[model samples]
Target: MQKILVAGPTFPDVIERLKQYFEVDWNQGNALSGAELTQRLADKDGALTAGELINAAVLAAAPRLRVVSNMAVGFNNFDMGAFNAVNVLGTNTPDVLNESVADFGWALMMAAARRVVESEHWLRAGEWQKFQYDAFLGADIHGSTLGIVGMGRIGQALARRARGFNMRVVYHNRSRVAPQIEAELNAEYVSKEALLRIADHVVLVLPYTRENHHTIGAAELALMKSGATLTNIARGGIVDDAALAEALRAKRIGAAALDVFEGEPRVHPDLLAVPNVVLTPHIASATEATRRAMANLAADNLMAGLGEGPQAGHPPNPINPDVLGKARRS
Candidate 1:
């Protein structure tokens, strides 16, 4: 049997299924360091990863490696050039986590718009003696303008939810989504600047790429209305955390919520000091059902790409299928 490395902890059922075909080396503890990952994959034939960095060095060290299946939708951790040069296929689980993530995005947006976290902290601290008319006054979500940056699957789902609030939806993407989709969601395509200027609440659901680092920064924050709320459920580095902290401190923008940060698992000290912002440890796709679906899809990709499962050699979500039949790097 071919040897496989599972770079992160996964569902036990998924592991049992993979055991039927391959010799599995599962990492159930802390994330492996770069040196440790390289040493471990040195002899493995295939691996399933979750947001673990896989670069040319790791690929070069793993001569037997043929495929890498990523458990999350974002594959920015993958160095595609290296995978292509070595003819090693990469895959990710998409669509499965869309609704779960969308739901979380909405939760974060509402929490920020309504000052939920700040007020909750105040209440827990015994600061609520009496309710004043202006006490914790916050931006209203219903009948407000909702702007979404990066109008992908999750973004569209968010737009669909806005209908119940009677919100006017505007979105900015690399290109407009189909007319039918826009009509169904009642989302209007607009420029990023225009969306920032007009929106009462803004949510980010875009993928991260090198060129788009800090998709929202001080300048963008300056463009937003003073009462607007911002929420990001997208990848880290998409927003400048320090800049966001400053904006929140100055009340340049009303409030902010983040599921990701520039360097996370270690949120910026500045953001932590601010009371207007709500922070979560990237649980946008943390629902049990959604996480299981991601794990199973990743397992399926690993098995199929390695030519062992029912769909042998035809993994459903190949990121670099062009490398499938090419010569493997020695």
Candidate 2:
């Protein structure tokens, strides 16, 4: 039987499915460290990961690793160049989590705007001695500008949510969405500068790439309205955490909500010091149904990648499709 290293926690069904075709040494609770990940991949023919920073060095250590399937939609975690060089098939779960993540993004935005977490903490501390007017006063979302960076499916979904609030939606992207799509969502394409300058609430939903590092930095932050709220549902490194913390301290941006961070699980110390910012531990797609779907789709990708299943000879959404012809031949 083909050997697969299940390097991260996954649903029970996924574990069972892999066991049907491969011997799975499942790590149900903890994913592997980079050093441990490389050592474990040394003998395995396949791996199912969840954005574990599997890079070229990791790939070089895993000569036998033919395929890698991450349980999440974003493959920025993988080093595509290395995978292509080594002819390793890489697949990701997409579409299943877009709406769920978009919903969470909107919630985070609302929480930041309304000072939800701050108020909750205050109430918990028994600070509600008297009902005071203008306490925890916040910016209004209704009739305000909603600016989105990296306008993908989730970004568009977020735009649809704004219509009900009577908000104007503007976005910045590498390529503008087709005019029809813009009309459908009632969104306008704007320059990054324009979006930052005019948006009352800015949301980020782009992918993570080297070129995209610090897409929102000091310069971009300076352009936003002083009292504007900021929300990031995208991957880490897209925003400068230190810069964000400083901006919050200076009241440069009214408030901010972040679901992902630069060095996650080890957030910037500065962010924890701010009162106007809301932080979450990267749970935008953490809903039970959505996470289960991500796990199952990852299993499907792995099974298909191993030259089995209905998708034999054609894995869904290969990041490096060039490897398929080579993998099949090998």
Candidate 3:
């Protein structure tokens, strides 16, 4: 049987499923370091990972590696260039977690706009004595303008949710989505600057790319309305956390919410100091059902890519499909 490494903690049931087809080396503990991962993968033929870095150096060490299936929609962890060069198939689980992540994005936006986390922390500390009508005043979601960066699956889901709130949706993406989709969501395509200027609440759903680094920086933040709220459900480094923290501290923008931060799980010290922001450890796709779906899909991708399952030789979500039939570099 082909040997595979499971590099992150996952549902044991998924492990059992994988075990039926491959010799599985599952790591149920903390994430393995690069050196440790290289060592463990040296003898493996394939691997299933959740946002673990899989690059050229690691590939060089794992001469047998032929496929890598990532559980999350984002394959930013995988070095696509290296995978393509080595003809190692790469796949990611997408679509399944879109709604769940969109739900979380909405939750984060509401939490920050309404000061949920800040007020909760105060209440927990026994600071609430009497209800002050003026205390924790926040922007209203209803009948407001909603700006979404990256109008992809999750972005559209968020826009659709805005209908009930009577929000006017405006989005800025690399390219405009289909006109039918825009009509369904009641969304309008707009320039990033226009979105910043008009939106009362802004949520980022863009993918991380070299060109997209710090997509929202000091300049973009400055462009937003003074009372506007900012929310990020996108990848870390997409926003300048330090700049955001400073803005929050100075009340340059109303409030902010972040689910992903640069160099996380080590957040910027300045962000932690600001009480106007809500922060969460990247759990946007964390609902039990959604996570299970992700795990199952990842398992399917791994098995199928390795030509061992119902969808043998046809993985549902191949990131680098060009490498599918190419001879392995090793």
Candidate 4:
């Protein structure tokens, strides 16, 4: 049988499914270092990974690696140029987790606007001796302008939710979404700077890319309303963590909530010291059902990319379909 590596912790059921077609090597513990990942892929025909870096060096070592299926919607960890050079198919699970992620983004925005985390921490620390009218004052979510940085699926979902709160929605995207979509969501297209200046709440849902790094930085923060809340459910590095930390420390913005960070699993020390910011380990698409769907979709991509499943040679979500026509190493 052709061999494959499940390069990160995943559902056991997903592993069982992969084992039906390939010799499966599964890693269920800590994330592997770059060298270890390269070493393991040395003999594999395909891989199913969650954020494992597959760069030029690793591809050079993995002579037989024909495909890599990433379990999340974002494949920023992938070195697409390397994959293309070697005709390695790359796929990601998308669409399945959109609603779940949108839900979390909305929650994060609300939590930040309402000072939910700050108040909870204060109560837990026995700092709430008496209720004061001015205590834990936070920005209002209702009847305010909501600015979304990316008007993609999750961003549209967020815009739809804004209607219930009677909010006016404005979004800045790489390009404008269709007019019907804008009408349906009651959203207005705006410049990033305009959105930052006028919004009472801002949520980021854009994908991460080299050009998109630090989409929100010191200057962007300075443009925001002093009473506005900022929330990020997008990939880390989309916001400059250091700059955000400084803004929060200076009360430049009302509060901030982050679900992703730069150099994550290791948050910035300044952010930790600030009491107004809310931080969560990246878990936006973490609902049980959504996660399972993502895992199964990834498995489908892996199987199809490896020519082992019903959709053999036609993975549903190929990041680089041109590779399908090229000679695969496997």
Computed on alpha carbons, the lDDT of every model, listed in order, comes to 0.94, 0.89, 0.94, 0.93
Candidate 4 local distance difference test against the native: 0.93
Candidate 3 per-residue C-alpha lDDT over 1-330 given as tens digits, one digit per residue, 9 for 90 to 100: 999999989999999999999999999999899999999999998999998899999999999999999998988999999999899999999999999999999999999889999999999999999989899899899999999999999999999999999999999999999999988999999999999999999999999999999999999999999989999999999999989988888899999999999998999999989999999999999999999999999999999999898998999999989888777896
Task: For candidate 4, write residues 1-330 as lDDT tens digits.
Answer: 999999988889999999999999998889999888999999999999999899988998989899999999899999999899889999999899999999998898899989999999989999989879999888788999999999999999999999999999999999999999999999999999999998999999999999999999999999999989899999999999999999999999989999999999899999999989889999999999999999999999999989988999899999999989678652
Error at 2, model 1, angstroms: 0.4
As for lDDT, the candidate ahead, 3 or 4, is: 3
What would the TM-score be for candidate 2 when compared with the true structure? 0.97
- Model 1's TM-score against the true structure: 0.99
Which portions of model 2 show Cα errors greater than 4 Å?
A: 328-330
Candidates 2 and 3, the one with greater TM-score = 3
Q: Candidate 2 residues 54-163, lDDT tens each? A: 88888877778888998877888898887877788899988899999999999999999999999999999999999889899999999999999978889999999999
Give candidate 1 regions above 4 Å deviation. Answer: none
Error of 4 at 298 (Å): 0.3
Whichever of 2 and 4 has more TM-score, that candidate is: 4
